[model samples]
Target: MAAVSATVILLIGVGVPVSIVAPVPQARAEVAQEQQRATDPAAIRLPSFGSSAVGVVGMPGVLAKRGPQAPRQMASITKVITMLVVLEKRPLAAGEDGPTITLGQRDVGYLDQVIAANGSWQPVQAGWRVSQRAAIETTMIPSANNYAETLAVWAYGSVPAYLDAARAFLKANGLDDTTVVDTNGLSSGDRSTPTDLVDLGRIALANPVLAATVRMATADEPNVGALENTNQLLGTDGIDGLKTGTYDTGANLLFSATRRVGDRTVRIVGVVLGARDHPTLDARVPAVVDSVVAGYHDLALAKPGQVFATYETRWGGVGRAVAAKAVSRVVWSRARVVRKASVDPITGGRKGERVGEVTYSVDGSTVVVPLVLDRDVLAAPVWWRLTHPLR
Candidate 1:
């Protein structure tokens, strides 16, 4: 490249042509893959745990199902819906239990039926009044069958009425494949698909009261007394609220997790149904999650004040175009940063004035950046202008 002379004075009666060219960016053979097969949710290895499915509600929105989509037994994960309906009918603010639900003779009868059937129990007594928050914790943490019924009756006055409300809630929330025949999930009648459960996890975590209640490893309330949460994976590896379920059908788990990558928080909601056992689910769920966490990468396509191209005039001027802002996003797929620069060489331009533009396309999303002049580009000297022959 020849040095553009700056000391040379413009000549009189002589016209000189000026033009500048900027190089276009090149993409590598391995760049911009159609999919990140290595870490894509569909491509990752899943444990053999009968019929299962996995999904994520995120910026990229990923979903994969390896088993049947038909409704299957969801076990105690039904409690998630139970808690959601309770909060929906009687909303609870942060740290607010809303109101007290007094246990009645009917609740005591529910208690007997649950205990006689060998369903989960949290020691509910007749005439015992507990705050709505405590009630949610009771049903969620210990997977209490009776508390679930007690809450439904307390909120809706009867099990049949509660089912009516639950059915509406399911349809309104777009959970078309899920139907709850029993609130406690003790009966095989309550059913959902692995795909539908992901949406269930999303709705459950969206409510503050229910989100906080399910994350507690142990509940120490007066009504429910000391009870441990069924989800043993809570507080591990960014895992938080949600519920777990197990029955003859198999083990199931719903999770809400957050991991930091670059400047963004990547939140993941995952559901897996039909694992061999609790231990198998504990191991397999995280293994599936690890694929997502590790795949998140800070894709820096541009930086503030970074010059992508330059232009020089053959007559006497030079200028550069720089990005005005930084562009970085958390991505799990291929990042192909391709830029097309359209520049106009000017006889004069003010510093910061847009002299060119760049179009950046990542995946299918496109962003246009205005390239501004990095410094003032002045016209040729007055003598050079006046002395130039009129063509």
Candidate 2:
């Protein structure tokens, strides 16, 4: 009886720990996934002739190009540069009239010069007291060559000084391909590439005063009476304003527009250099704007209950790791989207248990979605555990 009792005691002690504390089989995850749908680039329509480029404001590089990247005559678009430079010296807050600038003999001389050259001008006379905003409006709205020269001289002391400042501004802004010969773009030497002008457009839009002044279709100036904007494309096709220029050889336009894409507000900047005429350039701009707007889409990243990984056990238990809810992202031009999944081994758990997670990234933004089990994974039967020792 003593020998039998000793053997039974040893067996009971060993079996109890084996059944209670022994390890269960780990769940094996198989990473099987279906390919995401592919997207194509939009057919962006560009001007048939001349040079053109378009880009989103915050994005890097141009989205579309139709002509050579080499510099071309940028006509009155030079005023945009002039405005940028002058504002650097004489900055103005939005809605502030700034200091009063009294037109003098030099300003009148500027007006006479533009009239003689057959360039754009608004009437200005010596001794006419004008607010700084009015001068800017006159310069930009009517493409007045005289006010441009006047603003340049006023801000930096003379056109030559303004030229020096302009060069500095260009260098600082990375517009290496752009050259400004005079305060106004009247000189054919005023040259820039479609690419550089697009970047310039971004710079102009960033300035609050220039942004507001350029969009005005008409402004009542103290000296010039009611001045009309040279950019007729304003208030059309969502185009607000930038600048316009034309010379004997060709016309050019640096334009900006506000567009909506999937609940996101987008600013688009573009340039058309060497267009045959203003009408032709204006006609092609809408198509370019539309193409850019169409490039953004809401991409579906994951669907509710979509399986990302399959969980299986040696004990004949099976489960699935799935997305808990739908997920999506707003992306531009089919930007490359990438995903990664992380799942943990499991012995058994109830349905809807959080297993792990999946991370998605696109256009420098990230999104995380939780992964859950599709069904409960039952533990190995007690009889099986008792008969088969844990390895």
Candidate 3:
């Protein structure tokens, strides 16, 4: 009877081993699924575009687009590129004197035609040479066609040369579908999509000088009388001067605005094309700007030190465990989906110990990557160590 009793006890102890199980909470699983869905780019329904348009509200990659791939005549917005190319290749120092620009016969001819058409002009008289500074200011503030042509000639020695340089600049900046037939957006042939124009605006905003000039509501030049920016958005709280383009075929505008939301500074770039007229543009651009502002939010899907799971260490003594935090906080569009994640332990882990890991499915296959301990794990407490030292 004693032997049978001992056998039964042994069987029972062997049948049920002492173990620790940490199950993920229902809320956590839901959060993970939500995050996964948000990170998947295919799930998002980005705005559609007729020719290519892109709008970036703030960081965290909240990119909205309409006709983001379609090409359209950019008009004066092309001057954004003209200004960028000049700044990149031949930068002028702040407070430095302007460079002398000799007015050539071709420049004079172009100026005459622009003035005759009553197009935006800098009052550039024939044989009246102007400083490079004057030409740039005129081009930017009033969207002067002659000023752009003059600057193009000064920079590249001729209109054709300037166009080649502009084309090269566009190609280098991933504006493959864009083309520039002229430095000034006067020609309808010089076309780009709203997507490309947004990119150009971002590039221009990076330059302190260019950004400052664009923000100015009015500027004076030797050749051109006081010029006011055609951009109506300028000086309208949160609206900075970008550029406006108009022609018989289409009217377009590219605007970059900055506003403080809580402790963060949010920058919004808006592009509108094919508006019927100035009034239409005025009505539409502000709405787009407001949309971007309303959509902007601090993506709080992930938090610092938030633990996704807790796992026991295989090699460590009893009561030893590890906690894993979500990877970097991700802020992406709604449709983006996160297929998988990885964990990197910061401290206290033994070799082969389950410090952390990520389990996810991708394309119908489960993939796992182990997160090893970043720091060495000390032995268990002295009291526990005495009884549970490395077996």
Q: Write the per-residue lDDT of candidate 1 for residues 191-270, one digit (tens) a residue.
A: 88877887888777678788778778997898556989888888888888688888864788877777787998777787
Candidate 3, 1-391: lDDT as tens digits: 9999999999656533321122211111111221364432323232232332445543422266664446778888888889887766668777544678777677778878887765666665567767666677888988988878777777777777777788888888887768888777777787776666777778788777788888989887766678888998786658896888888755677888886644467777767777677666666555556655555444333333444443333334222222333333223233232444444432234544554455544324454444433334544333342333332
Q: Which parts of model 3 are misplaced by more than 4 Å?
A: 1-52, 57-62, 67-69, 95-97, 102-106, 126-129, 261-263, 300-332, 335-391
Quote each prediction's TM-score: 0.84, 0.87, 0.65
Better of 1 and 2 by TM-score: 2
Q: Best lDDT goes to which candidate?
A: 2
List RMSD in Å for every model shown. Answer: 8.0, 3.1, 9.0
- C-alpha RMSD in Å of predicted model 2 compared with the true structure: 3.1
Candidate 2 lDDT trough over 10 residues, lowest sum: 32-41
Model 3 worst lDDT window (10 residues): 22-31
